[model samples]
Target: MRVIDPRPLPPGVLAAFLDLLGPERAAEVRAAAVRIARGLDGGTLWHVNSTPRGGGVAEMLHVLVPLYRALGVPCRWAVVDGDERFFDTTKKLGNLAYGSTEPADRLGAGAADDYLAHLELEAAQLAGVLGPRDVLLLHDHQTAGLVPALSAKVAAVHWRCHVGVDTPTEGSAAAWAIMAPLLDRADGVVFSVAHHVPAELAGHRVAVVPPVIWPFAPKNEPLPDDATRVLLDRAGLGSGPVPGNVVADGPRDPDAPLAVQVSRWDRLKDMHGVLTAFAESVPDAHLALVGPDPAAIPDDVDQAHWFATCLDAWRALPLPTRERIRLVCLPMDDLDDNARLVNAVQRAADVVVQKSLAEGFGLTVAEAMWKSRAVVGSAVGGIAAQIDHGRTGLLLDDPHDLAGFADLVTAVTGGAVDGTALGDRAHEDVRRRYLPDGDVLATAGLLTWEIT
Candidate 1:
C-alpha cells in the first residue's frame, strides 16, 4: 500500500459554496461538518482504491478527501499496489459487476486465491499504518477483498461501490456471489444507487450515496474562452505545435460545432458507437473522443489494447469522417494540468454526450453538466438518475440506438433544441444533487452509523 500525497487545497475553498448553497444551506453544511467532527473523536478517515490518477474513483477521492479535511475531518488517501495479473483479475470482476457478458475465466478458485494473496500483503501494510480509532472506506471491487483482514484493525470499515447495472444479469449475479461473502465483514456498504446492492446482502447496513463533483476542481472549474482556445492549441487539437503528451490526428475545426465525450477507453463507455453515430448522421459537427493516455494507468492491463483498437477503428473510417473525428489522449504526468485541459475541452464543447452502455455513476456527465454545457446521455445506471430527459439534459432510452443517438446530437447542433437552456437547467440540477455539501452530510451519516 502507498499513501498518495493530495494536492494542497486551502480550507477557505469551502467559501466557493456560499452563493451556490445560499446562507441557510451553507450554515446547515457548516453545522453538519461541526457535528461530524465531534462524532469522529479525532479518528482519521482513510480511503483506499486501485489508482490515484486515472478514473472517476481517484478523481472523486482527490476532490472530496481534501474538502473533508478542510471541513476539520481528519482524512488520508491510499492506493493499493497491484501487479498486472492482479489488475487484470480485478478488471474482469469489475466488468462482470457492471453486467458485462464477457467470459469470466479469471473468477475461478485459483483467481480468488491470487486476489486474496495480493490483498493479504496490502492488509498487513495497512494494519501497520492504521490506528484502532481510524475509519477505513474501501472503494469498488478492487479493494473489496481487504474487508475481512482489516476489519479488526480499524474502528470501522465501510465499502463504497461506484458501479452498477440498472438490470441484473447472470454475469452480475456470479460476480456478486463471489464478492458478497468478502463484503459481509464490512461495518456497512455504500452504493451509488439502491439497485446496485446485491440480494445476498439484504440485511446489511447499506446507504445510497451518489458520487459528487467539486465545482472548483480543475476539471470542472470555469475557464475563459481565450484560455480554453489556447489550451486546446497546446494540446494539439488546434493550430499550435503539438505537445509530446497529446496524440491527435489533425487540427480540430474551430468553426464546426464540437461534440465531446470524455471517458476511459473502455468497451462499456461505447466510444466506437459515438464515432459511428457521428460519422453517419452528424455531418458538419466535429466529435472529439477524449481519454487518458493508455500507458498511464498501469493497473488497467487492457488499456493499451483497447486504445489501440479504438485508433484502428478511427483509421478505418472514410477520409472525410476521419478528419471530423479527433481521438485525443491527454497526459497524466501533472494531474492538475490534465484536469485543466479537460475543463477547457468540455467548456469549448457545443454538446457533451455520455453514450455509455452501463455505468456506476457517470461523473463525466455531472462534470460537464456542472460546467453548464448541454448534455445527452444514455438512460442507464446513474446516468438515468442524473439526467431528467429533456429537462436538465437529454437521455437516450436505448444505448445501442446509433440513429437515435445521432438524431439527438443533430437536434442540439442543428438548433432544433435549445441546448443552452438545457445546459442552464443541468447546471442547477448538478448543483442540487451532485455537489460535496450533500455528499458530506450523507457520507457523514454513514460514518456515524458505523461508529455508533
Candidate 2:
C-alpha cells in the first residue's frame, strides 16, 4: 500500500462544509445521520459488492465504512465469492440492466440452490465472527441475490443500486425476478440518481443517495511535487520540465496544452469517440487517455482475450494521432498514485473531457470540478446533473460531434470564457453537491428513516 500523508480531521474541513451547506441545513442533516447511527446500536452494517476492488461502489465503500466507524457506527465491507463462470453470468446481467439482450444461460432451478449454498457457507463463516445485530447493506444486482438467504439472520438489509435503470430488458427482468424476492425483503433500496430507480420499485421506499468524494482522504488531497514526479515516472508519462505536468512523473512544457480523459476502456465509455472528438477539435493539443484496461479482470471468463481485443483497437489508431495519445493501466493497488495523476492532470489541463456514452453519476466530473478544472462531458446520465452549460463546465450533446466538441475545447482553451470564473463556479458546485459531508448526512437520514 502506498503510504499517504496522515489526514487529521480539520476543524475547517467540517466548518467550511457547514458554511457551504449553511448552519441550519447542515445541523439538520448531521442530526439525522447521528440519529440513524444511534438507532442501530450494537448492530454492524455490512456492505457487500461484486468485487472487493475497482469500480465506484467499492471505491465509495473504501472510505464510507471507515468514516462510519469514526462516527461510532460499526460497519464492515465484504466481496461476494464467485468464479469466472459466475462473473460472466453477472456481466450478462449487467448488460441486461443497461437494456442489452445478448443470450445468456439461465440461472436455472439449481442456480438458486447453488447460490444459496454459497451464501449460507459465507454467512456461517461470518456469523462465527460477527454477532447477529449487524445490518447488511448490499450493493448492485450481483450480490442482491444473497439478501433472501440472509434476511432471517440479519437485522436489516439495504440494496444500493449504482446503475441507471431507465429501460429494462428481458435479461434485466429475469435477473430482477431472481433477485426481486430478496429486494422485496430489504429494509430499503438506495439509488445514486432519481432516474436510476425502476418503476416496479416505486411503491417500495427508495432513497436517492449520490456517491460522494472524500475531500480529506489520501486519494483526494493535494500531492507534493516530489511525490507527483515519482508517480508520473512509474506511469511512463516522462520526466523533466514539460507543459502542464498532469502525469506526475511526466515532463512538463509550459507552452503546450493538454486534454485528458480518464475512464475504463469499456464500450459504454466511448473511449474511441473521445479520441475522434479530440482529433477533430484540437488537433494540436496533447491527449492522454488514462485508465486501466477494461478487458482486464480479476475474475471473469477469457479476460485476457478480451483485453487483447481492446489492446488491438488501441494499437490500430493512426500513428500521428496515436503519438499524441497515451494509454496507461495503473495497478489496482496504486490508487494513491492515480489520485496524484488526476490532480496533476487537472492542474495542467486546459480541459478535461468525460465524453462517456453512458455514465453512473460521473465521479470524474465531480473530481475535476473539485479541482476547479474546466470540463466538457457528454450530456448523458449523471454527467448532466453535475455540469451546467457555460457555468461549471460545458455539456456536449453528442460524443461523436467532433466539430462541436472541438469548438468548445478551442474556445475554453483559447480564453473565450473567463477561465478563473469557470473554475471558481465549478469548485463551488462540487462543494455544494458532491462532497462527503453532505453525502454521508443524506445517506444517514435515509437509513435512519428506513431502519427506525
Candidate 3:
C-alpha cells in the first residue's frame, strides 16, 4: 500500500481554498487535511447522498470531494434521484428517524418499495462510473437503501449517519427495519456522535466521526470588513453600528444588542420556538432570522400557511416590538453569499441563537463559534455536545425559557458576561476538534484500516 505524504503541494493552489482561522490553528488544520488527502492518493472514493443542493450533506460533499482530488485521491460524487412521491416518503422517514411517529405510509408501503427499485436502477446506471474496488460511502437514509444493491461489487461500503439516534420510537423502528438490511450489508457504519449509532450496529465496525467545517472554504471564512459592509447593505440592514463600534450606523444602532438565528426554516429547527422566546425576552435587541427557505417541506403542502402563521405571530406584536424583528428568507442558490452573511452577522451580533428541537450536528453553531461569537443553543442532540455552557457557549434546556434566554442575552450583551472570551474559547474548541481537514483525514484512516 502506498503511504501518500500531504506536503509538497504548491503554495496557494489548495491552501487558498480553506476557511480562515487563527494562524496557529489554520496551520494545524491544513497539515491534518493534507495528511488525510495524501492517504488516499491511489484510492477511489465515491459519495452518494440525496439532493444535489439545499442541504448540509450536499454542501459538504461539494467542497469535500474536490479537496480529496486536489490532494491526490480519485473521488466522485453522485446524487440519488426520485420523484415527488419518493422524496415525500423519504422525508417522513427522516422525521421518524429523529423520533417522530409520523406515518410514512407513502414511503413505508409501495413508495419505499419503489424507492429501492429506483436505487437498483441507479446502481446499474452508476456501475460504469464506479471502479470495482472503490470505497463507496453512502450518506444519510435516502441512499442507505442503495447498500444491498451495490454490496457485491464495492471493495467496502460505509454508511455515514449524520443525525441523532437515541431510543427510536415505533415509527423509527419500522423505517429502520426497511433500511436495516442495507446497513447490515455494509462493512461498517460511521456516525457523527457515538450516541447516534443504533444499538444493533454498536458492536459492529463503527466509527464515530464528527462532521467538520472547512475553515478556508468560501462559506466558512471571514470576509473583509468592506465585503461585510457590502453584504449588510444588500441585505437591507444598512451600515449599522457593529456591537463593539463607537458609532451607530443606519438601522443597526451599535449600542443596541443584536441577536441572530441562522438555520433552515424547518419545524425541526424550531424557528417558531425561537421567535416565541425572542418575543418575550429582549424587545430592544435586533433579531435576524437567516436561512434559505427550507426545502424539506413539500411545496404543495401548507408551507405558506406555516410561514404566514409565523409572520402573523410577529405582526401581532406591538408596533415597536415588531420593528425589532427581521425575518429574512434567503434563496437556496445563494448559499455562498448566505454563509458570508452569517459570518458577518456573527461578527456584528452580541448573541447567536440555535434553538433546534432536533438537529444533525448544527454546523451553523460551529460556524458562529468559529467566528468568535457566543452561542446559546438547545440541549438536544449534538448541540449539547458542541457547547460547554457558560464556557465555550451556553446550552438551554427549555428552549421556551424566554426570561432565562433573555437574561443570558442581556448578560452577554451588557458586558456583564465576557462574550469575547466565550467566542475566543469557541474558536479554539472548533479548530482543535471540528475542522474538516481533520475529519477527512480521520475518515481516510478508518476507510484504509477497514479495506486493508
Candidate 4:
C-alpha cells in the first residue's frame, strides 16, 4: 500500500466552495465539516481506493480529502497496491456491472484467491498502523475486500461503491458473485443510485449520494480566452487563434461549432459511438474526445485496446473529415496542466456530450454545465437524474440511438435549441443539488451514524 499526496495540490476545497455556495450555505457547510473534525475525539478518518489517478473515484477523493483536512479532521488517503490480475478482474467486474455484452467474465477460485491474497497483504500492512479509534472508509470494489481483514483493526468501517448498474444485467450478477460477500463487512454502504443496490445488499443501510465536481479543480476551472490557446497548444490536444477558440489543433472555419466529451478512454464512455455519430451526421461540427494518457493510468489495462479501436473507427471516416475530429490523450505528468487543458476544452465547447452506456452520475455533465455549456447525454443511470430532460439539458431515450443523438447534436449546434438557456438551467440545477457541501454533509452524517 502506498500513501501519496492528494494530486494537483488541491486549492482549499472548502474555501473554493464559498463563492459558489454563498455565505450562509458556505458557513453551514463549514460548520458541518468542522463538526466532524471536532467530534473525532482521537481518531483519523481514512479513505482507501484504487489508483489516485485517471477516474472519477480518484477525482472525488482528491477533492474531499483536502476539504476534510482543512476542517481539522485527520483525513488520510491511501491507494491499495494490486497486481495486473487484480486490476483486470476488478475491471471485468466493473464492465459486467456496466452491462457489457462481451461474454461476462468471472473470477474463478484461483483468481479469487489471487484477489484476496493481495488485499490481505495490504490489509496486514495497514492494520499495523491503524488504531481502534480510527474510522476506515473503503471505496468501490477495489478496496472492498480489505473490509473483513480490517474490521477488527479499526473502530468503524464504511464501504462506498462509486460504480453501479441501475438496471439488472447478467454481467452485474457475475461480478457481484465475487463482490457481495465483501459487503458483509461494511458498517454501512454508500451508492450513487438506489437502483444499484443489489438483492444481497437489500438489507444494508444504503445512501445514494451524487458525485460532484469542485469548480476550483484545474480541469473544470475557468480559463481566460488567451489561456485557452496557450493551455490547449501546450497539451497538444488542440489549438486556435485568439478568436477561433479550438479547431482540434487543425485549420477549420472559425465559425464552425464544436462538441466535446472528456472521459476515461473506456468502452463504456462510448468514444467510438461519438466518433461515428459526428462523422455521419454532424459533419459541420468539430468533435474532441479527450482523456488522460493510458500510459499514465496503470489500472486501465483496456485503455490501449479501446484507444486503438476508436482510432480505427476514426480512420474509417473520410480523409477530409479526419481533420475535424480529434482523439486526444492529455499528459498526466502534470496534473495541473492536464486539468487546465480539460478546462479549456470544456469552456471552448458549444455543447458537451456524455453518451455513456452506463454511468454512476456523469460529473462531466455537471462540469460542462457549470461552465454553462449545454449537454446532450443518454437518459440512463445518474445522467437521467442530473438533467431534467428538455429543460436543463437534453437526454436520449435510447443510448444506442446514434441517429437521435445526431439530431440532438444538430439541434444544439443549429439555432433551434438555445444552448445558453439550457446551460443556464443546468448550472443552476447543479448549484442547488450537486455540490461538495452536500457530499461532505452526507459523509459526515454517515460517519456519525456508524459511530453512534
All candidates: TM-score: 0.96, 0.83, 0.85, 0.93
| Minimal lDDT window, size 10, model 2 | 1-10
3 versus 4: better TM-score goes to: 4
Clashes of 1: 0
Per-residue lDDT over 199-223 for candidate 4, one digit per residue giving the tens place of the 0 to 100 score: 8787777777888888778877767
lDDT by residue (391-450, candidate 2, tens digit) is: 889988876577887877777777786766777899888887786666567556655664
Candidate 3 residue 443 C-alpha distance from true site, Å: 2.0
CA lDDT, candidate 4, residue 17: 67
lDDT of 1 by residue, 1-452 (tens): 99987875765667876567888878777877787677667778899999998999999899878887887888899999999889988988998899987764337668877998899999999888898888888999999999999998888899999988789888888778788999878999999977878787787898888899888888887788788878888666666765665545567777999999999988889998998899888979998889989889977777777677878888898887888887788888999889999998888889999999999999999999988889999999899999988888899999999999999999999999999999999999898888888877876787677322
What value does the lDDT take at residue 282 in candidate 1?
A: 90
Superior by TM-score: candidate 1 or candidate 4: 1
What is candidate 3's lDDT per residue for 228-268, written digit by digit as tens?
88767555454643332111223555467888877766667
**lDDT, residue 204, model 3:** 65
How would the candidate models be sorted by TM-score, starting from the highest? Answer: 1, 4, 3, 2
Q: Rank the candidates by lDDT, best first.
A: 1, 4, 3, 2
**RMSD in order of candidates:** 1.9, 4.7, 5.8, 3.0
Would you give me the overall lDDT of model 2?
A: 0.66
Runs with alpha carbons beyond 4 Å of true place in candidate 2: 1-30, 102-124, 127-130, 167-178, 238-254, 293-310, 400-403, 450-452
Q: How many steric clashes between backbone atoms does each model show?
A: 0, 11, 5, 0
Candidate 1: where is the Cα deviation over 4 Å?
A: 104-109, 241-249, 450-452
Task: State the lDDT at 110 in candidate 2.
Answer: 66
